[model samples]
Target: MVVSVKRDLYGNGRLVKASDLSLGPRQCMPSSQSTATSVIFQQGLQDCGNTLQMTSDWLIYSTNLTYSPTPSRNSPIIRTNSAVILIRCYYLRHGNVSSNAIKPTWIPFSSTISVEERLSFSLKLMNDDWSAPQTSTVFTLGDIFHIEASVDTTNHVPMKIFVDSCVATLSPDATSSPRYEIITQNGCLLDGKQEDSSSAFRSPRPTPDRLQFTVDAFRFVGSDNSMIYITCNLRAVAENQVPDPMNKACSFSKSTNLWTAMEGTSGICSCCDSMTCATAGQSRRFGSLYPGHSRIGKREADPVKHWLLLQEHKVTTLGPLLVISTEQSQARTVTPLSSLVQLWVVVAFVSLSLVILTIFGIVGKRPFKLHCRKAGLK
Candidate 1:
């Protein structure tokens, strides 16, 4: 993120020069913070460098206000405290040169910055190239659906999102009955084991916040031409954490003779064969979709519980994707009528009615005229 200062920012009726402002730990003039040069009267600072950002390369950084200790990026934040990244930029309106780079008359200008904590989740259906969203929701049997599930916490800490479970249901409610479980037991791809199935995750993920997968489309055996909604349970963790059995996406690979993970460390996928990848004794509790809690780093007396914070999760759904067989699709196509076709049908009916009425009028008049001629002859 870019940090900038205005040129005309004045103190005591004097303009603040660019070199007078310093950022980072020392707060010394001409601060040597590499994180992009501070914007000012140079290179159109009005556009790009007007606002100050609190992040450097996606990680939040902070500088001390009291001490000249080195700038640190590591700090613990809990529920008691706000999730703010403190930054201090020294603007020495009046200072003197000294043996040390720091000025004795330096003044500290501090700003408290915090990222948004709210998170949003969604599941999307993509087309072949994954470049665009699928326009047509109708899919014939044996077709494939390219799915992407993600969590969005725009300015919050970076997180690695995982699809804990994915099940297709006729209803929007994920817990509904007559469900077809595709990915279950905390990221195991059950459908991937089927014969001739191409269901698995798209490897080389673009980001940990999004997961891509392909599922061969099909409907419930007895339910044909039905609407199916795919609801997936997605969870997220800190990006720095490692992918464990519960948080990794695993797919069965027939060619490799072992289960594989998209995030690597295939050893975590070994239990996928037995469908026991979830943590021991932690069964999926449908009693509550959101069982645990939202606050991640609570200030608890129990240290162990603090470190083992519960990850955030959301149940995101995408579909009403029409599932139909080839025969059904063909029948629907033949029976469907466009507005133009319907308008033509109405026009034809009106014209036929007018022709029939004209013919009847001519026939009735001819009979009357013939009778009148007979009477005249008599």
Candidate 2:
């Protein structure tokens, strides 16, 4: 006996089936069908056409029959399942090329992966013919290149480009006095592990008269984690004029010895004051001439006569005469003794005369006597 069963597509379990067990001795014989009829019957059971024409509801069968209702080859699911989608990328390219032919080039996925995964990237695309960057380029995730700019502190109109550090040169508009110096807070010129003690920047020296100095700063990007700080000290020397009281000019005549003795004839002597005398000269021969002594002979003999009298007399008055007549000069002058000596001599002479007259009066005799000879009387 033969048996047949019916089951669901998944076939997790079997289902019962029914079939006839008894049969008559003779049954009508079946007729053989042509190949076209068989082919037509098969075609009617299973439909075949382009996937583009298929609708979502249409049942599909896989070649292996492992899956049913397979997605269409033209759908997004097929593109995702297979590696058919192409992604475009971009990046910077460096090389000499004609300006007109310049165009953006695509970057490979492998190269962009470093920037995308690490979340950090840098482009030194600007003209950098100078030194290296002061700080490290390493950055934590989410960090961004904030800004890039330049200022013409030097005030050069054409604008020269400097690399690595921000060049904070002395501006031409800056004040001429009180010279300015440039300083930096971040890294300085580096030579191996050592940093240069000198400033990384440049500015003019301090002015001559100004006591204080003006300082300027220029900062560059430093280590990714650190902030910049700058400070400077200014060394300056100022010029000043000190008054020389000793060399100050005196208002009195410098030529007269008596005047010099009396602190110059003006009677306004600096000797007693804070100032000191610097120069002196002798008075003219006729400086002390009497009304009738203006004669040329007297004038010519004045110096000799004055000298002889000063030597012979030893009197205070003669000292003034001698000092006034002679042409004696000095680079620096002090008070002369002639005036004091003369005053003492005058007092001595007056006292001596009074004593003589007193003596004569006490004796009751004349101070002077006149005698006449016998022959002159006859």
Candidate 3:
């Protein structure tokens, strides 16, 4: 019985094909030998017209695998293992154009995929405008374009895409003159709560109900220096679902490029002459706890009284007007009256005690002792 066999063949015997040992869907016996693996890739390219004349491409790669092997003495094998790979690529187009003159644009495009094939695709330009037949196209100043790309993750597999670099070239164009002024406007409400609402000042949490406004003004100038003015009117309505009798209006202006509220005639002119303005004012008037008096106890008598005063003084000439009404209840001081009553009570009790002590003292001092004596002893 001295017949020695190969240690690997002692447990099992099998043959495996290299092509069958993939990371895909397949299984094998201990000695049969099997493995599975797959890879996916994606890429994007872009080309812009005169503003951005160049070609760029990026890459993304991913892979996964699983393998199992039988243990053997002569050819020892591990149990099981899995592996994965991920990669990303980025390409930028470069040319001899100046940096200032290049205005690049990026647009995304979609890709097609097949079920059996590993996910892989490229974004190509549909029009020849992005690429030149002979040399790469050149972009000129003040030009705009689009770029496109797509992912075949249609297979519903977890995958990642990366953007490497984006480049563009620019060159001067006689006919490529700049035009159109850029104008931006923003509005906001502040119902005793939040402030600005623009992305520049957004909070993760919900803000108090308020209106916000912002404006950006731009214009192209040829030779002569000039000034431009912009005007805007803003109004706010309470969404509380309750009927409100108050009027809420906000008027704003920018002079010397500064934002300010509009008041009367003079203030109106200031805002009307500015290039940018934000008109924001509150309409909901708050009533005072006290009817006739201001919240601070100032004697305005009533809203009519305050209005009359405003009219007489012509305070509206100032920029932006804010009118508020508040009422405060009257409070009387009772400390003095209580102190007077206590002092009177203490005085009366002391006077009565002194009178009783005087009467007792007089009676105790009287020498009314009666003594009887015999005539003979005397």
Question: What C-alpha lDDT does candidate 2 achieve relative to the native structure?
Answer: 0.23
Reference-based lDDT, each prediction = 0.63, 0.23, 0.25
Clashes of 3: 38
Better of 1 and 3 by lDDT: 1
Ranking by TM-score: 1, 3, 2
Where does model 3 exceed 4 Å of error?
1-57, 65-78, 87-378
* Tens digits of per-residue lDDT for model 1, 1-378: 244444333323333334445443233333244223232222221232122212112211223111112222475432121111233232322322224564445333211111335455667778899997676777898799999877665645778888888999976567888898999887888889888788999987878788899999888878766677787888877887676676788888989768898885887787776766654213332122223544433455443355335467777666567777877777767556566689899999999999999999999999898998989953
Candidate 2, residues 65-179: lDDT per residue as tens digits? 1111234556644211111111111223332233646444665653343223311112121112223321332223222221111221111112111112112211111233222
Residue 141 of candidate 2: its Cα lDDT? 24
Candidate 1: the clashing residue pairs are none
RMSD of each: 22.2, 57.4, 34.8
Give the Cα error of residue 283 in candidate 2, in Å.
60
Q: Which tens-of-lDDT digit does each residue in 1-378 have in candidate 3? A: 011112232234443223222221122112232222221111121111101121223332211122234455577665433221111123343422346664444322112211222433232222223332211112222211112222333332333221111111111221233422111222211111113211111121121122222212122244221122111221212123221221221222222332222112223223223322233111123244344444633565454445323211100000011111111111123566678899999999999999999998877655332122333332
Candidate 2 has its poorest 10 consecutive residues by lDDT at: 313-322
Against the hidden reference, what TM-scores do the models get? 0.52, 0.11, 0.13
Task: Give the distance in Å from residue 196's predicted Cα in candidate 3 to where it truly belongs.
Answer: 33
